[model samples]
Target: MSAELTRLAERVADLERRLSATTRTARLAYSSIEDGAIEVYDNDGTLRGSIGVQPDGTVGMVAVNAPPPPAPAPALVDSALAGLDVSWDGQWANDEDTTPLDLALVQVHMTALADEELSEETMVAALVPGGGRTGVATGTYEPMWIILVAVNTSGVAGPPSAPVQGQARRAASDDILNGAITDLQLAEAAVTEAALAAAAVGKTAIQDGAISTPHMVANSIQGDRIAVGTLDGDRITARSITGSQVIAQSLTANELAANSVTALQLAAGIVDATHIKAGSLTAGLLAADAINGKVITGSRLQTAATGRRVVVDPERAEVSIYSGIAEEMQPGGLHADVLDLGASKQAGVSLSAPSLGKGTAYLAMQSPNTTGGAGSIRLEPSDRITEPGYTYLLARQGNSTTQELIESYASAPSGGKITVQQQTSAGFTWRTGTTSATLRDGVLSVPNIAVGTARVTPVADKPTSFRVAKRLEGKEVRAFVTASTTVPGTVVEVAATDADNTGFTLWVTRTNATATNVWWLMIGSDA
Candidate 1:
């Protein structure tokens, strides 16, 4: 079996060698070729079939048969829709000569079955050219519902017309007689003014009261045109006589009845001052609140009497009593002799000034004689004997306008703490003799000597020193020293040293070692 297998393997090798030689020398033809294209031809070399990229770059195959021709463009039909009439030949018979330029085609959609209910899915569409007509294919006399849609060249369709019924037939103008179209047959406003000849409508043509105001042009009727007594109150419409219709100054008092020209009859702002007679309008003629918010100018209230005219200036919100005529009053503000506010317990006056400034309330007293007494502002309690606490009068100091002297009375009994204070940075002064004594910063200074007492302890038989509280300007300080306890034979001495404007120093001398407590009296010139 091994030998037989070897023989078979040798035969296979021999067959492969023969096939390799044949493949090298012989050519193999393929029934179909792939790279982009393949063409089949007869012996005449005419192309019969091909599978290749077409001229449009799409891969396709073609046989001897050609593709079907594309569908023809839809035909156009001219017909009138429902509620519209067309000629017998199905042409639009409208008076207009122009047609839509963009109307390229019309699609005629009709119900498919004779009695079938019409819907979009059940209807069959037949396209036609715009304004062209075609006959229906129905044999029976039954009506077929149809709808027409206008299509442009871009295949865009406009809204469909109303569905039409029955065949496409309409009565022509030639079929109707001359007077057959009556008013009932014509649509509303069919015959306009332009359709009638000039002066064609005479008095007999219009019925009585048929020609209303709207039928006549504005201001067309004149007095001369109307017969006398032809137009009376019943003939004229209410408010029909406008301002332009009435001649200027023609309507006098006799022309209108009394109280006839009321507010309702007159236009707003038409009755100006020129139309109104002076002094003709009385208080009874005006409404109660007619002048509630109205402005009255000062010129309207001028008077000849002096000190009797009161001028109220609305702009300044001020009322001034004038002592003379209107021309004598000041132009800007109130110029009056006096402004007297009548006695009222609740009414109090207030005056304000700018910041960092003082407001002054002046009182000028008329003295009977130059010697003494004058009218003064007396401040007293309303119900009690004493005035209220902190109730004081403020007055500017002599020759200094900014400095004020205040004398405040306490709220206590008669002997209470009444104090006098002054608003000054330079302190207060008390003038008695030829010189004045100034008290500043809790320190009392005098032109003469100031005396005070102090206690000091001195070292035994040693000279000791201490400071004095009183600030003295002069160095002339005289001091006396004595032992605080009763010492029989103790000698002590006190002397002032280092005297300056602020303070002074006092020195003490004691002879006995047992004596320490020393009392001293200092007298110094403070000024």
Candidate 2:
């Protein structure tokens, strides 16, 4: 029996070892479940916890019991409760004559104490209700303990409630009531453009005619906002549309009414060349003195009808006129006003009028009247055929005054010749080099004459002569014997005679036969 018991024990031990090894292998093969929840159950088979997806599709651990979570603290009420009221009697009144005192009017004083400790010095007094989570008006935002006490009608204070700790904060959106805020409650500039939502302000929000020039910002009312046919002449104030208000190039002929714009309505210098349409302005459209003081700037002022133009070139500082004459007319044509040209120094005025060989080109200065005063002085081309390139100056000093004529002719490749004549008694004077010659009252007086010396061989006791290089007709000839090679102290005398235009004779009288030098002078008029 002992041997059998021993064998049986060994078998039991072997079975135990095998069972242990099988359990470990099963654990290693199935370490975790592929799907399904990992649930924990209590001894009674009640699910205590789970690590799996909940019904709301969230994967998290769930505590099924959670020990019934300690009873929750009382929630704060978001409203004020009614205050307790006490019945009171006036001073010296009987018991029947009692009055009910409203505790709300009795002023419940609330004090907010500092978080560190509660003291009188740290308490801020504010009037508030006691019950139903009433708030204490506190200036500070720090966490603090608030205590409240009710005052009786007799001004006696009641016992204070237990202090509650809280923090002062801004009222949330839920604390505000609908339509509680009004215009009077809003701060200045509190409602800005960004504060309004898109399309928040509708047409009904604005009153009729409430917006004025002061209220609307500049250029705020765009064209898209204005309804068609809404803005018209009657809607706009007179003279209110200034140049700055109008868009550039926006106003066309169709946009303007006839006679709508006038000088008074236009600003000074606002109308420029770009503003005016071509051929839009005419002589009749302008006032007679419209441009009197105004400056007209352009390249030229031209007449379309006559092809006359006056060009002013500012870069060159020059002015030129074409196909026209410039005349300054005075009232009644009797004023002695002078036409001034080239007022600046070194300035020149050129008057050129070519005849193209069809007529004469002359410069004439005439009197104002044809019948009186000094008549005219005319300088014109000479009419003499022999000197086609000659010019003459004729001065007619009226009917009572003498007329003077001066003629100038040029000989090709040589020099020029000038002739002067007086038609009356009055003559003129001419200066050449250091000598001056005057012709007056039909008499010519020359300060210097042509005097020359010539040697002549005289026949024995006879006259001898030589031809004068210059014509001596209509002249006085004077001859004198300067020296003689004849016998010394032989008494020689010279006489000028037979003086014609071409030649002259000089007679030498000497007692001996010898040559004599005679000096002769001739004074006459050049005709």
Candidate 3:
């Protein structure tokens, strides 16, 4: 019986050895995850072998004085970039300090070697069991090895906007923060630039329409102007600009500056007849003739040939010195110049008449009595033309210097010798000779008038006494005084202002009554 028991015990021990061998092989094949480096023991977990990462990056098993298991077949560790997890080798794990820091360093070296082909991005993660978590930080590795791990403690999050119900909330938060920081910096810089100019507005910020009120006379402008502003005349000089108004006193004293008022403003004042001092007494005031003051209207002034200019509108422009028309002042002696705007359109004095030539007819003249009326511009035969007007020259009919003036007159039916009145200007004279035509101003002017025959006998160098009567409009006049003698071939006319007579002739019925003997008497209402 003892022999039989010994044999059975040997068989039992042999079966136990086989079972242990199978278990050890199975364990070596099992995948090990680690906090840093993981180690796996054989059956009964005596640590006869280890399935842990080495510094050489190979799994090492310390073969003690014991039978060796078969060499491990090539293993395919279930390495996945996603969901990497690690834990300590639980059975015989040492304290965290027992692990050498060099072990982690070696693992980091191995990890760097494996990712050499990779850029720094993939190599940034340590390669060890704990490379999936924190290498060598917490626990075991074949009692020596460690690992570097960058574990993701934060789970998946997205961009930010605080809705909490979107896909990329966290990522959006990061982007928005970066953009807002840039914008805030720019706004800060702009605000810093604006606050320094404290004394006044730096420039004109035209918000809408410009303010049109008058500017303060003393202030300097920040920007452009609707109108000009200035200190009073005591401060500075100024150029005249339009739309500027003046408030100070006379320019000649210590008033507004010279030429300081704008031309446009002055034009307005002129039309309104507003009184204004022109400029300084000594220097810059307007000349006497410069300003078009109160609408002054008269004829062109006649120069006295000595003194000042005068108004000479003799025809249409009337200058009544008191109540009646002044006779002498005329247009031709001195020419018209310088205009003030008319009170009416007729205010500008105009003198126009229809005449034959281009000679200037300045002042129209009239005597007190006429066959027509006061306005009738006429000259009678008995009346003489005088100065400022009639001059005699040798006959040159076409020359403008010898202006031919034809004044008309008629004989008084009562035998008034045709009256030719003289104009009132000084230093001139005119008379009619005993002829129907006379040489005047380079022309033989046949006056448009008929004269009564002088009741003188036609005998040679003789006199015949006859009664000559003068009448005007059927009224007789005692015109002729005595018997007149005439030379042969003379055109004689009676000179009288008497209106007491019947129709007259050279002879009422002569003893020798021929057409030449019986004279023709001029009869008209002028008579």
Candidate 4:
């Protein structure tokens, strides 16, 4: 068995040597082939295929396939907006007739920017050769933006067209535009509220009072438009303020002045339940005897669902009457701080009102029914009114100018009425208020410093002088001719001289002789 195995091993070694010899021969055959030529053969030496280098430097092999090379990319097109100019307002143009380049411009790309940065692009067809310049309207106000790029037939976008800052054609103001002015005609921020002049507005500017219901836009005049306190009696014309003018329940108690509204001012049959808001009118809002048995009628009282009408309670009525009487007795209806008067301070004598603030007071009358009453109440300062240091009384007749009658800190007997007087044709008649001193012959007997102003007619002569009714002390006199009947450019001068406690004299001089008027004012302590 060993001899047989050795024989098999020898056979195997022989086969290996033969295989090596065959590989060497194949390598030799492969190396001996001609330049760029290759041929494959079967075991029997029959030709199967051939391989050689072609003229193109590619290795050509029989029965071998290869993918074709990829196609080259197309070149970019050119763009040019030749002869660009502003043809009209918000429009631009390019010279289409001038054919500088052979390529036809199929389409043109336009890029516009405002403020030189923000940009918008648009595409437009190029007009044929010899056609009117290819134009485009920006449809906007003069834009200062540069057209970033414009492209043409070559398909290449050209550089920005010479930094064209477009300007819109301005319409000649001197010429008659004939067309109605539209918002487009105005520039941005034009026609602003601050730009409008005061004289441009107002009633005078409006023809035939056009600033009325038909002209005014609804909800245009808001509350802020009307200055506070401007909508008073004087500003609002008679019968001008209608029911629609007032807001629903907007008029509060504080807004309504005492006795400002009267029956004459109110429209007849307009004071019904529908007109007045619920819970708006209260008893405190009414005057002392605003509503009485005669004032209240069957139609005035509202009837409930059960047909029962509202009635005032006797207890409430009595309380209101007593409260009103107490308020009137108080000095100026102002609540005063209680002073430590020891036992001398009377219990029922002290009078005050909680609604009256310290620094303010109500003008009250001791006996309103008595036109010329003996009892008078003067205003007294409370602890809160300490800044002023002293109290003052201001008196004014119906539509007459208000005058500071008295200023003092002198106290009077507790609960004793202070006697005051109002100027009357007969003489100074006793009224419902107090002064620093008593009155005599229609004037205060005490040293009364008063300010008097009066218009004096100037004499046509050069030495024009007039005596004022009010007296002056220590030459405390001032005069000014606020208005005059003299012609324009006429110079006039007025002077106050010869001042005395009894009266003061006013002298005048005029450059151009003309009748004129002068006003004078004097301050003195002569009643």
Task: List the candidates' TM-scores in order.
Answer: 0.22, 0.24, 0.15, 0.18
lDDT for each residue of candidate 3 in 449-526, tens digit (9 for 90 to 100): 233433233443333334444333322323333222233334233233323334333322223322222333333433
Candidate 1 lDDT over 233-324, as tens digits, reads 99778887766688899988998899988779987667879999999999999899997998666542434345546655555444444434
Per-residue lDDT for 43 in model 3?
69
Candidates 2 and 3: which is better by lDDT? Answer: 2
Clashing pairs in 1: 75-128, 75-129, 76-128, 76-129, 77-132, 77-133, 78-131, 78-132, 78-133
Q: Relative to the unseen true structure, what is the C-alpha lDDT of residue 85 in candidate 2, on a scale of 0 to 100?
A: 18
Preferred candidate (lDDT higher): 3 or 4:
4
RMSD of 4: 48.4
The number of clashing residue pairs in each candidate reads: 9, 0, 49, 5
Q: Indicate the worst ten consecutive residues by lDDT in candidate 3.
A: 159-168
User: Quick one: ranking by TM-score, best first?
Assistant: 2, 1, 4, 3
Residue 508's lDDT in candidate 2: 71
Ranking by lDDT: 2, 1, 4, 3
**Which stretches of candidate 3 lie above 4 Å from their native place?**
1-261, 264-267, 270-283, 287-316, 319-377, 380-527
Best by lDDT: 2
- For model 2, state the Cα shift of residue 390 in Å: 4.0
How good is model 1 by TM-score?
0.22
